[model samples]
Every structure is written in C-alpha cells, then in structure tokens.
Target: MVANTQMDADKVKIMGSKVKVDSIMKVADIEEAEKQKMKRKVDKILAYKPDVFINRQLVYNYPEQLLADAGVMVIEHADFDGMERLAAVLGAEILSTFDDPKSDVLGSCAGIEEIMIGEDKVIKFAGCQRNEACSIVLRGSGNHILDEAERSLHDAICVLVSAVKNHRTIYGGGNAEIRMSLAVHDLANTVEGKQALAIEAFSRALRQ
Candidate 1:
C-alpha cells in the first residue's frame, strides 16, 4: 500500500515558528521538485509489484494514471484507520518509508475492483490473506442512520475478530453459563467443609 502525502506543486511557502527565513525558487524548479518526489514514491511502490495500491489521501491524476498504466488497482482516500484495518486483513505491513520494503511487507490479493452498491461506490478486495478481508456497504436515508450503521458494523467486526483469534465458541441463551455452573457444582460436591459451601455459592451465582 502506498500512503504518502501529495504535495501541491503550485502552492510553495516557507514558514517557521521560532525562526524567520527568506528563500526563493523559480516556479518551474518548485514544480519539478514536487514531480521528482512523486516519482520516487511511485518507483518505491512499483518495486513491490503490489496487486493493489491503497492511498490514504486523494491521488492526483498523474499518480493515478501511472498506477493504472502499470495495471495495478488503486484505492484512494483510505484514511489511516482504514489503512490499518486493510493491512491487518491482508496480513501486510505498513511501511512508513519505502526505503527498504522487504518481502515480508508485501501483501497479496486475488483481485480488486470498484463496484456500485446502491448509491455508493466502493472498492472490493477479494481473496485476501486467510480470507480475512471484508467490505460492507451501508445504505441509509440520512447521515445519522449511516453513522449508526457504521458504528454497529464496527462493533460486530471487533467481536468477530476476537472470536477468530481465541478459537473458542460459546453458545447463546446462557447455555455456557449453565454448563459452567454445573461443572462448579460438581467440583463443590467433591470437596468438604466451608470452602465447599463457598464454591457452591459461586456456582449458584453463575446460574443466576
């Protein structure tokens, strides 16, 4: 994933808080510098030969066209949190700088595409590492509804991830609690004295 700041070539300014400085450069020189920086970033990304490029900020036409020409899918405006989630889902590393992107940092996906669901357009990544990636398209009548839906989906995903990592299952309707209570009760029966009474009480609480 390529997530870098895209500097505006037309907007060049020098400002400092504790110190003052004066510097001038030709417009062509400034623009050329920006283009060079962008080219370096693109080259670093292309070195990995990634199947998809996820940009944290909106990519200008130049970089977008460059990646497209190289036959790589591009996802623009993916915020920091979204990028982190994608990295986790794809089992990839987020390299702050592309100086040395080792083989371990690269991620793979079967394919990526832009799909329209309802009134919204979303990019979908398929066949991610361990099939861990998923995308949900929310449809709502208002902003409030959409916000609520997003929050709900986030909570659900958190629970799902926890369950997957733990590799433990517990049934609903208090069935697991009942089973625990029964096991504790059996253990209490095997013991003797006041400690047994305490264990019995604990098991009873679990039943409640």
Candidate 2:
C-alpha cells in the first residue's frame, strides 16, 4: 500500500502558521501469529492513510505540492531550502502479547516517493511515524526550516506505533518520533574553510 500528502505556504497562513501533531503506534511481533490478524493489520493502515495525510500534512508542512505524500519531493531554485526527515520504522512482525514490547521495527521516509517541483526552488522532507522519531535535517537555515520540514513529514495516521518508549533499534536508535533540530551542518564549533559561507546561508535561510 502507498500514501501521498502535501502542504503549501498559502494554506499554512490561513490555517495558522503552526500545526500541532503528535501520535503513538503499537508494534508487535507477528512471528508465530495467525493469518487473520496480519490481514487485519494491513487493512487498518491502508484505510487510515488517506484521512491522516489529508487532515494533517495539509494543514501543516505546507509543501509546494500542498499535500505531503509517503514519497519525497525535491524542488530546485536559487532561493532553495533543504529539509531531511529521519523516520523510525518498527521491523518486528508478530508477538502481540506485549502491548509495548522492548523490540525494534523498520521505518520509512514520509516522503515515500520523490516528487520534483519548480525549475529553480527546491524543498524536501522525510518522516518516520512507525516506531521512531525520524531525523529531519533542514539546510540553508531557511526561517524555521526545521519546524517547516517536521510539519511536512507528519503524514502517517497510525504510524506513531509505539515500541517500548525507550526501546533501542537494532542500530542503537530509539523507537519514538523524537524531533531533533539542526542546520545543514554543524558550524557553531567549527569555523574553518567555507564555514563563513555556510553560516551566511544559514542566517539568510533563517531570516528568509
């Protein structure tokens, strides 16, 4: 199954510049589990995908496409801003006895597919609403880029799937939609080479 969502700037203004979104999902091990249960789970997700994408991403992120989809969108322009969202996915299938087990799951990018926009201006975002807080990196320091990207990637309706709140992933990450904000690169401590340019870009992006 697949889902698409988008958000744009104008709608953002009317709906308010900021939209609040928070979710929780439960992931269970399907190993040794029955067939009917698995079918039910898949059906549940496909059903809710549309509702969440429309109601949530639409009012928030405000991408040029105006709808935030599972795939990604890369727009090109001189006045470009960069946004990367890291979503946490739960991998385990069966084993539902535990409401919230200390297990790990797989994650997917909220921008499931990549959709290009504009011949010059580009904006991108990613999300992980399954079992982890996706990491979204905003480039160019565009004004509130982090918040903008986060809002764009909040697409999944049932993806806030919860594993043990503090459960670690197979790669040593947590299982929650934790939002961490940062610039294209770290410049606070390092001022070498093009650090000045990077900083300038960040500053302009922040103010722009």
Candidate 3:
C-alpha cells in the first residue's frame, strides 16, 4: 500500500518525465494511488489529521477526497488537444512563484509517474516539481508556481500527466516529465489582469 505522501511529488515527476504511462498504469493500478498521496497531498492532509493512518483513508475526520484519487491533479493526452490545456494550466504561474524562464532548464518540468481512473489510461503530471526548498526562487532547474489557485490547478494536471510519462531512468515505470505550457511575466494586479491571464490561458488551451 502506498502512502498518500507520494501523491503530489509523483504527479509532477511523471508528467515531466519522458516515458509511456498507459502501459505502466495498465499494469500497476494500486501504486498509482499511493504515489499521489505521498507526492502531493499527504503533508496538507496530515496537518488536519494530527496522526497518519494505514492508507489514504485517514484515521482522522478530514476530507477523505483530499487523499483519494479524485483529488489527484492530472492532464490527459498531451499528444493531441491536451497540450493547449496543459500550457495555460501548467504555465499559469509567474516569476514571483518561480515560474520564471531560464536558459539552464534541463527540462521544462521535474516530477514522478503513475496512472488514473475511468479509462485504462496512464498519465504524467507536471508543473512546479518538488524540491527541498519548494518556492518561486528555486535553482536554475526547478518547477515553479505563482499562486494558490495555480498550484491547485497544477496539482490536478500533474495527476493525469504523471500517469502518462513514466521515468526513463528506471526499468518500466519511472518519473515523468513536462515542459512550460505558458509564460506570463507580470500577473495582473488588478481584477482585469487576473481575469485576462485566466482568459488567455484557457484561450490558448482552446487553440491547441
């Protein structure tokens, strides 16, 4: 049984990594849940738990979906119409959140891999990969974020994407990889700026 702690981390790593998720998740369904809990949401969940538990089903009375697969963030089918959705969603963050641009970015994103539900498809989630010091001002090589909403959106995409892109460094299923979908230097301080950013992002997704 995988812990919920791996949820968020797995999401980003998978989406960013370059691998085949459908084949991997098709084989490993259970581990996918475990990855999501530990990678993305456990720490946040534990804060409410006060004490951890056996599976993602918390012993404490907290939002169960917080650990369930439904809560995991993911983007689907990056090869087709998915890229546009991913671009705005993944690149929604700005420089303040470390979504900045750099020449040394080995890969646009950094994260793990896993699978998803409803369909027999695996995915790779990306955007703002995990780091010891996870924030906007990470090293030259770092995934970034801009705001809380963007972070949440990022997590959602990570879940779906991660299952697609498995780790190449490993044997069958490894970490995933993703690239910057969009780049916004100055986020709108005014209500319109914020709205514009969102509109632009989704618009780009529609275009793709």
Every candidate's lDDT: 0.75, 0.34, 0.37
Candidate 2 per-residue lDDT over residues 42-155, each given as its tens digit: 334333332222112222332323222434332222111111112214222322122332323223335644345433433233454454433334454566886766665564
TM values, all candidates: 0.59, 0.16, 0.17
Q: Please estimate how well model 1 matches the true structure, expressed as its whole-model Cα lDDT.
A: 0.75
Stretches of candidate 3 exceeding 4 Å from the true structure: 1-77, 92-107, 126-208
Best-to-worst lDDT order: 1, 3, 2
Residue 70 of model 3 has an lDDT of 37
Give stretches of model 1 more than 4 Å off: 2-25, 136-208
> Model 3 — TM-score against the truth?
0.17
lDDT of 3 by residue, 1-208 (tens): 1122222333334555664556766536545655644534444533333221223222322224443443433221133233333333333211111122342321234544565543444445445333212222212223454355567767986865676686433323321111112333123223384687785565455335
Residue 56 displacement in candidate 2 (angstroms):
21
Tell me how far the alpha carbon of residue 8 in candidate 2 is from the true structure, in angstroms, after superposition. 36
lDDT of 2 at 145: 81
- For all candidates, the clash counts are 0, 62, 59
Note each model's CA RMSD in angstroms: 7.6, 26.0, 27.0
Please report, as a residue range, the 10-residue window in candidate 2 with the lowest summed lDDT: 78-87
